[model samples]
Target: MQITGYKSQGVAAAVDLVNAVTTVEGDASFAALREILRVNGFFWHEFEERDAEPLRRWGRTLREFFDAAELETAVSLLNELMLELPMHPHLADHDPHGLHLHFAPPTARLPHRFRASTLMQLSELVVQHGLGRTGTCAAEGCDRVYADTSRAGRRRFCSEACANRTNVAAFRARRRTPRTPEGTG
Candidate 1:
């Protein structure tokens, strides 16, 4: 839950957003990052009292890009452009917060931060947890990604609803298949 500093926070936020998008059906249909961030608080912008419309639109756009089938390609190219190394910066204290290394500029355009943070976190996930942990929901018709944060990395479906639905469907399939009188294979 609690990541160490800004770098950690940024990476965590990226992972959280990626996981959130992957679990739903389609390559990229969901666009609820603002709500997700409001609940999770990825950046100080979300906490701003002035106006959050800009942030909301930014979040939506990020989701749209994330949903793009070419996301991997884009991230790879962006990573090259940003020149990110496989390193985590040390925590340094900052305004209104404790020690934290600013992984990104607070004033930077929303898209820049969004892409940078996402790519960085995804790269971290691949290195730290292995790409095996990043996966799609097992339920058919559901195309959301799953980061497997559960105790057992065996999480298949995006949610309990999908899990239940898949299980019920499996049970029905079994019932529909005529049994071979127990003696024959």
Candidate 2:
């Protein structure tokens, strides 16, 4: 389903947070993260000399800290926790872009803004659809989470690549496993 700029930002921000946690133990470069953040309109351009403090001070390797298992646990927690946040209108024109709510203004410290905006978005979703809609990718070995905006509610992977890879792996595993004779243990 289609979403507006404000709604998209909320989803993008949540996806970004999920990306940070999921990539904690896997191979996802900052550029890749940037791309994902931008997917639904959460911009992450490189500023020549913008104060790096807020961005860097987040301290830990956001992605590398949460393993796949931990990432799943976090998704569940976030899904529930996000329900408690309130969506207040903090609309403003910060960029050359048109008017929009800050949700959590971009000018704020990167980490704080990210967390607040993301939570706001998830909170919005929770109020609208409840916790059953937001979820982690169903594919094993993938910790990616999506807001599941699909009309049919059938999304299972963060992307087609993960879905295809998972299916292929399953097919190979079945081929490799030894088969027993009929009625044999």
Clashes of each: 7, 4
Q: Give the TM-scores of the predictions, in the order they appear.
A: 0.58, 0.56
Candidate number achieving the greatest lDDT relative to the actual structure:
2
- Per residue, candidate 2 scores C-alpha lDDT tens digits across 33-148 of 55545564555664222423333322122222222244445456555544543334477775655776665544554445555565555555545555455556678867766666
Clash pairs, candidate 1, are 22-144, 22-145, 23-144, 23-145, 24-144, 25-143, 92-100
lDDT of 1 by residue, 56-134 (tens): 4433433433343454654564456457423334454666567644445666555455555655655555455444445
Positional deviation of 34 in candidate 1, in angstroms?
A: 2.8
What lDDT does each candidate get? Answer: 0.51, 0.54
Candidate 1, superposed: residue stretches over 4 Å from native? 1-32, 44-101, 106-111
Q: For candidate 2, report its TM-score.
A: 0.56
lDDT of 2 at 182: 93
Q: Could you tell me which 10 consecutive residues in candidate 1 have the lowest summed lDDT?
A: 21-30
Clashes of 1: 7
